[model samples]
Target: MNKQQILRNRPVGVPDEKTWELIETEIPEVGDGEMLIRNKFISMDPAMRGWINDARSYIPPVKLDDVMRAGAVGEVMESKNDKFKKGDFVFGMGGVQQYKLTDGKGFYKVDPSMAPLETYTGTIGMPGMTAYFGLLDVGELKEGDVVLVSGAAGAVGSVVGQIAKIKNCTVIGIAGGPQKCNYIKKELGFDHAIDYKNENVRRKIHEYCPDGIDVYFDNVGGDILDHALTALKKKARVVICGAISQYNSTDGMKGPSNYMSLLVNGAKMEGFVIFHFADRYSEALQALGRWVAEGKIKTEETVIEGIENFRDTFLKLFSGDKRGKLVLKV
Candidate 1:
């Protein structure tokens, strides 16, 4: 039997227990050119909330009663495909399930020896790709640029800060709590860390980037985005990755009221979907792998066991309880 978590209802603000339903279903036999994956890890991300909404977005919404949309890493228990063989570890959009039966589309073989399977969901995976392309390409980063990243201790934001440092930029990271701030600054090698929970965010940003921000990588958009906008230099760029802060807003998204700073400073803000850089994934992965090997970038992930406890595990994304990438071990 395969236990699959399916979207039971469209959530309004925060997803409740009724929003997802887990059921045991008969595992299908592998057919010709097909493979059966015994999922080992499931990725928990803030974007999962937008996926269940009954609205138009970058990708189609997860249909009602369908398996919840997610990125997972697993081992191929059985395979009939020429490209993949049995026992091969792979990463794909395997969703939130104990097992996945796929025809091998949208799947890629991953080297578990290179990094832990959960790192596939964090550092070298979609979140990593998003940070790689979002900062260098969309943000048009230059060496020595004063770069600021929100959610700096998160899966995506952490990578952004590290990459900025590698490119020889002054990196300032904004995170909640003293622990997370210290993690980014001391462990991740960020030039500065702003504890939004305790510090005056705007004042700290001013003190850190007195020369003005050249590039702002926004992961937790809201007041922090406004703060960054206010600190933008002439010809600055803002990369909009994910807005975790406004993901579950009951009222509405809080867009930057300080957007006028862009015009005054002759700066620009652009949003990107990671899929847009699909063709260059291999390139990004190679660079990320090299950085990991050289100890230039570190992978931070929190793993929780059991697919049955997915609800509580996923809640950690919004509750500010988990660090780095939150992965569920199946």
Candidate 2:
């Protein structure tokens, strides 16, 4: 039998127990030209919040009573597809279920020997690709430029800071707690770490980047986005990655009050979905892999055991319950 978590309702705020219903069912059978996967890990992301909303977005919202959408890494249990064989490891949008049936369209094989199976869900996976393209392509980061990153202790932000350093840029990270701030500065090599929980964000950003910010990579939006706007240098680029701060708000997303700064500074702000650069993934992966192998970049994962804890584990993204990449081990 396969246990699955299904979306019961569209959440007005942070999702609670009432938002999801768990049930057990017989494992799905593999059909012609299809494969069956036994999921081992589920990737919990802030983007999942947007996926459940009925509002129009890049992708369609998950329908009611359907398995929750998620990225997962798993092993193929049965294969009727010629491309995938039994015992092969694969990654795709396998949802929050114990077993997944697919036709091998978006799915891809993964080599666990290169790194741990879970790292593919973090630094070596979507988050890593997002940091690469978002920073270099969208942010238009340059050497010696001053770069500011929010959610710096997270999977993507941590990689962003390290990549900026590798390119000879000054990197400043904004995070919630002293421990996270310290980890970014001392361990991750970020030039500066601002603890937003303890300090005035606007004042601290000014102190760190007196010359103004050349690039701002935003993860948590709301006030931080406003502050970054006020600090933009001429022709600065702002990469809108994810706005986790406003994800669960009953009120619609709050527009940055300081957006006028963009016009005043002749700056640009762009939002991107990683899939837009799907064809160029190998380009980023090669560089990311080499950096990881050389110890120039570090990856972290916060793993929670048990699929039954999916709802609580997902809430950790908003509550700051854990750091780095949040993943569920089944």
Candidate 3:
């Protein structure tokens, strides 16, 4: 029997076991042009928090009683598509399930020779793609630019900071703890890192980015976003990839208090939904894959083992317990 976690209720705050129910089910069969995959690793992301709400967004919210939405890396067990075969590893939005059936619509075959199976979901996968387009295309980063990123220790944010470093730009990362901040600055080679939990965010950003920010990659929006906005230089660009801080807001979303800086400096801030660039994903992937192969980029994944821990694992993002790309090993 295949086991899956179904959303049992909408969460008002941090989700717990009560928010989801684990159920046993029959194994799904492959249809024409479809493939059946046995999940190996499942991605747990901060964005998953937003996906639970039934409000409108880039993708539809997961319906009640349906398998909780997630991206997974798995081995193909059966295939009716010429593009996939048995034993091939693949990755996509396979949800939180022990088994997955894909119509080859949103799935991609994984090449382990290039990197590990888990790296696909971090470096060569969604988080990597989100960082790439969100930084280059949306942020319009240029050489020598100073970039500021929130949620700097996270999957997408870590990559965003690293990619900025690779492009010859100065990078400043904002995370919740000293350890994560140190990892970003020392290990990841970011120029600066601020621990929002310890230091004054606005003051640190001002001190580190003395010339003002040239580009801002926002992940955890709210006060940090307001801080970054206040430090934007003339013609600076801000990319809103995810506002994790506001995802579970009971009072609704908050805009930057320093948004006037945009008008004053002629800077621009744009919100991006990664799927909008779905057609050009391969273009971004090819370049990003090359960087990963050459060690110009690094991928970090914090995996939790078990399908039964889906609800608890997902809440890690909200609690800031996850240090990198959060994934569940099912």
Top of the candidates by lDDT: 2
TM-score computed on alpha carbons, candidate 1: 0.99
Q: How many backbone clashes does candidate 1 have?
A: 0
> lDDT value for candidate 1?
0.94
Candidate 3 off by > 4 Å: none
Clash number by candidate, in order? 0, 0, 0
Identify the superior model by lDDT, candidate 2 or candidate 3: 2
TM-score of each: 0.99, 0.99, 0.97
Clashing pairs in 3: none
Q: Report, for every candidate in turn, its global Cα lDDT versus the true structure.
A: 0.94, 0.94, 0.89
lDDT of 1 by residue, 93-182 (tens): 999999999999999999989999999999999889889999999999999999999988989999999999999999999998999999
lDDT by residue (1-330, candidate 3, tens digit) is 899999989888667667889999999767899889999999887788888887898888999999989888999999999989998999888889999888877888889888888888887888999999999999999999999999899989999998999999999999999999999988899999999999999999999998899999999889899988888899999898988898888888997888899999999999988889999989988988998889888778888898988877887888889787888899
By lDDT: ranked, best first: 2, 1, 3
